[model samples]
Target: MKDINLTKEEKADAIEAIKSYFFNEKDEEITDLSASLLLDFILKQIGPLIYNQALKDTHYFMTGQLEDLFSLEKHVQRK
Candidate 1:
């Protein structure tokens, strides 16, 4: 599957949604049941793809930055 891309705001929204699910609904008589059900719903709705893409994109940018820094350091040492 093609990777999912989430903007910063989308990421923040997703986190807030999960937190609300846990906190706001904790007093339900079947709290454990409801929490598990909601968590699964999230996973099904937008969990795996978004999270994996975020991780992969972050790694790609970090690797590029590291390479650039290493090259700059080498050039500086040579000067």
Candidate 2:
């Protein structure tokens, strides 16, 4: 699988979030480098699961829209 890539800003944001989580939840101070490494690890290990869930949500949404459209078309044609 291709590596999960984030924009520079996104990476920075993620790294900061990781740092905050460590500080607040874990009660440990994490450096930017540590947060970055952790971010990469999480992305590599967990990103696919999140991506798949998003795709499933999108597919279900589109299917529902299509079904509604077809139902509306049939209803209009019967008039």
Candidate 3:
């Protein structure tokens, strides 16, 4: 899988969220750099798995919809 690139604003927001989680849940204070690094690691290692699962879910949903559509087809009676 290709690298996932986040926009500047998104990256900033994610970094802030990471910092917040560490502070709120772990009661630990971490710098922006630390949070950024952790975010990078997560995106690099875990992002592909999540992305693939989402694609599979979408494919399954579309396939079901197509089957439902096919069920509505009308058959012509032959003489």
lDDT of 1 by residue, 1-79 (tens): 5444557676566656666755777642434445455556766677777878989999999999998887766444553
TM-score of 2: 0.84
Error of 2 at 78 (Å): 10
Q: What are the per-model numbers of colliding residue pairs? A: 0, 0, 0
Query: Candidate 3 overall Cα lDDT vs. reference?
Result: 0.97
Task: Please write out the lDDT profile of model 2 over residues 2-76, one tens digit for every residue.
Answer: 788899999999999999999999999989999998898899889998988999999999999998887666434
> Against the true structure, what is each candidate's TM-score?
0.40, 0.84, 0.95
Top-scoring candidate (lDDT): 3
Residue 45, candidate 1: Cα error in Å is 4.7
Flag regions of model 3 displaced more than 4 Å.
Answer: none
Give the per-residue lDDT digits (tens) of candidate 3, residues 1-79: 7899999999999999999999999999999999999999999999999999999999999999999998999998999
Pitting candidate 1 against candidate 3, the one with the higher lDDT is: 3
- Superposed on all Cα atoms, model 3 deviates from the true structure by an RMSD in Å of 0.8
**CA lDDT, every prediction?**
0.66, 0.90, 0.97
Worst 10 residues of 3 by lDDT: 67-76
Which candidate, 2 or 3, has the higher lDDT? 3
